[model samples]
Target chain A: MTGFELPVALFLLANLAASLWRVLRGPGDANRLLAALLFGSTGVGILALLAFSQTPAATPLLDVALTLALLAAITAIAFAQRAWQRGTDPKRADD
Target chain B: MTSALAFDLLLAALLLLSAWQAMRTPHLGRALLAFVVFGLLMALAWARLDAPDIALAEAAVGAGLSGVLLFDAWRAIRNKPDSGKNAGDEA
Candidate 1:
């Protein structure tokens, strides 16, 4: 890795560490969910950077980032839909 | 310590802290949030370890998918009639 890459990646990791507190101490699920979302974007960034720095085939790694970005949104949407369904489904047997 | 090592150490500490909270918190909502945060931190950790492939997978599968699943579960539980009766209990 380049001289600068190491430090940049390290700083990103440190910030991620701080974010952990919010996940642990959040008052509600909304906070936690947002934290997880934050992770998705951050991970993509860190991965893209590392890929470009360390690997020759950095192009494919970008696909991973793109997939992550797309999937993260899908996950949030799916959860919202399920939650809405559960909220509206009065007849859910298990409750 | 070198900057990289210091960063790694900080990431490690935070990962442990968040994981602990995610697993141990009494409030389900807070626990879920912690879990999501933990996943993200884990992705970072993987990147630091020089495994971008794993990092990407962790971000997409672990953080993205798991966070949604946990929140969905929380919402379902919260919306239950009995849950309303015990709404005062945040846990």
Candidate 2:
């Protein structure tokens, strides 16, 4: 069972790589931020898989996954409430 | 065994890719977003390297706190027309 975990983790990583294109091709900041949220969740999944894959089972990784989940939530909330403003073009912001 | 190595290789590639995108992107917000992604990936890499403590710290400080700070900076830079214009000119 432990042996199966690594491939599953790899699959999740591939999924992340594919979704990353959306983040990269973003027409807006909000869209890129949404992709970042997806990264946070997918990251949790990968961490959980890695936790179980080890011979003795590295349960501490579960704690890491939990922290990641919490951080991801905080990031989304902060972005929605504080960082992003409506009608603000990030491209224009630099110019 | 081979699969584990494959996972590591892919993670490393992603780490490099995100880091590169973070540095190369012209848009400040996009670069910041890439940086957040890079931090999260770095945490995973730490976990894979058998450093759970480092992974925890990387996730909390690197991704969480740093992301918030960068966003604040982005907002501040956006508000300041002179600096924003100068940054664009330099880029």
Candidate 3:
């Protein structure tokens, strides 16, 4: 199981790198924000895999992963409530 | 061990890329999103360095709080009626 951890973590990192393209080419603000959401979820998985990969299993990293998950949710809520609108242009704010 | 090194190198590269994108991107909203991505990647770097405490702090304060604060600033700038005209003079 430990042998597979690093590879899986690397795969997730690749997932993150791919998401950056979406962020770069976003024709809409919502598309860019979706990439950020992808970062949050993938980051959690990377953290969890790293936590278990160590020989002694640094369990505190699990707590960090949990915190990241909660914060990701909060960040999404804040984005939806405060920054995003239904039909705003990427270059200009309607309000 | 080589794979571990590879993971760290990739994380470091991504971290630098995100940080650069956050600063160099012309669009304020996309730049802010890049900043959030940088923070998240920074947290992972900290974890890889065997510093869980810093990882936790980076996750909470860097990715979470900073993202919201930057968004608020983006909104304020966007809402300003004469922001574009005064862009050069305001700073």
TM-score of each: 0.71, 0.89, 0.88
Classified by CAPRI criteria, candidate 2 counts as medium
Clashing pairs in 3: none
Candidate 3 segments exceeding 4 Å error: A86-95, B84-91
lDDT of 1 by residue, A1-95 (tens): 55576577677766665665654554434444465466667767766765665535456567667877787677666654654332233443232
Per-model lDDT: 0.64, 0.83, 0.80
Give me the TM-scores of chain B across the candidates.
0.89, 0.89, 0.88
lDDT at residue A57 of model 1 (Cα atoms): 44
Q: By summed lDDT, which 10 consecutive residues of candidate 3 chain B come out lowest?
A: B82-91
The collision pairs in model 1 are A23-B34, A32-B33
Which candidate's lDDT is highest? Answer: 2
Q: Would you list the rank order by TM-score, best first?
A: 2, 3, 1
In model 2, pairs of residues that clash are none
Q: What share of the true interface contacts does candidate 1 keep?
A: 0.59
Ranking by DockQ: 2, 3, 1
